[model samples]
Target: MKLQIDRIINEEKIEIDEVIDFSNVSMPVKIVEPVKIHLNFENLGKREVRVSGEILATLRLTCVVCLEEFDEKLKIEVDETYIPETFIENRKEERPIEELSEFTYKGSYLDTFEIVRDNILEFIPPYPKCPKCASKTEEI
Candidate 1:
């Protein structure tokens, strides 16, 4: 879950390859398998890091209409900017509230698993429906 970025401080880009087990962490939705995440962390400047990656997993979803359990392939795009605490502390008042996509980190290490899990979970449908249920509802 911990991603070390010390090596990439000098390099322009660093590739992070990890297979994360999210069973231990409390997730918003049920997951059926481990997530495969591949990411690239690029140093934007002195204290900013750009994280771009792809996540793939299988999620266990319950159909809201039919009440059936089904597996769904979850794919998510990871794109975010991380700013150091030092920078945020100095310019917190200057930055606009609407620019909330930036994440703040205290140190060199980042919580890769947690960040990716949160982004992926946001894509889940609030009221999921199975194929049969969806088709039936369409005819009504």
Candidate 2:
């Protein structure tokens, strides 16, 4: 979802509860339901914003060994600081090792959908196993 950061730029802090559309979420596995995202944004200063939230969804994942599809809960905590591109340009020259790892936003909006998608994908294991399959493998 696209969050309007400009709205909270003047405010001290803001809390938002939104339901994201996972029906069109592109994933390696299948998302059986929509995602719920609860976010708190605070303006660190004029040029910086902090976004912290939780992404919750249920997914249909296939077990690698058994090859059976099963439902699983996907929950990921997101805590990121976003700054302008100019901030990176200024800091990049100071310390090359430190690097600019924080998220960057352009204009008045921040596209949070990509962040949510990436975190969810990273949370998934390369090899997924159901409870039954995991128990069977443990006995071996």
Model 2, 50-121: lDDT tens digits are 879898988888899999998889778888778887776676446454334467877777776776777788
* Model 2 per-residue lDDT at 20: 70
State every prediction's TM-score relative to the real structure: 0.85, 0.82
Model 1: residues with Cα > 4 Å off, grouped in runs: 92-94, 138-140
Error of 1 at 9 (Å): 1.8
Clashes of each: 0, 0
Residue-level error in angstroms, candidate 1, position 133:
1.7
Best by TM-score: 1
For model 2, which pairs clash?
none
How far is 38's C-alpha from truth in model 1 (Å)? 1.3
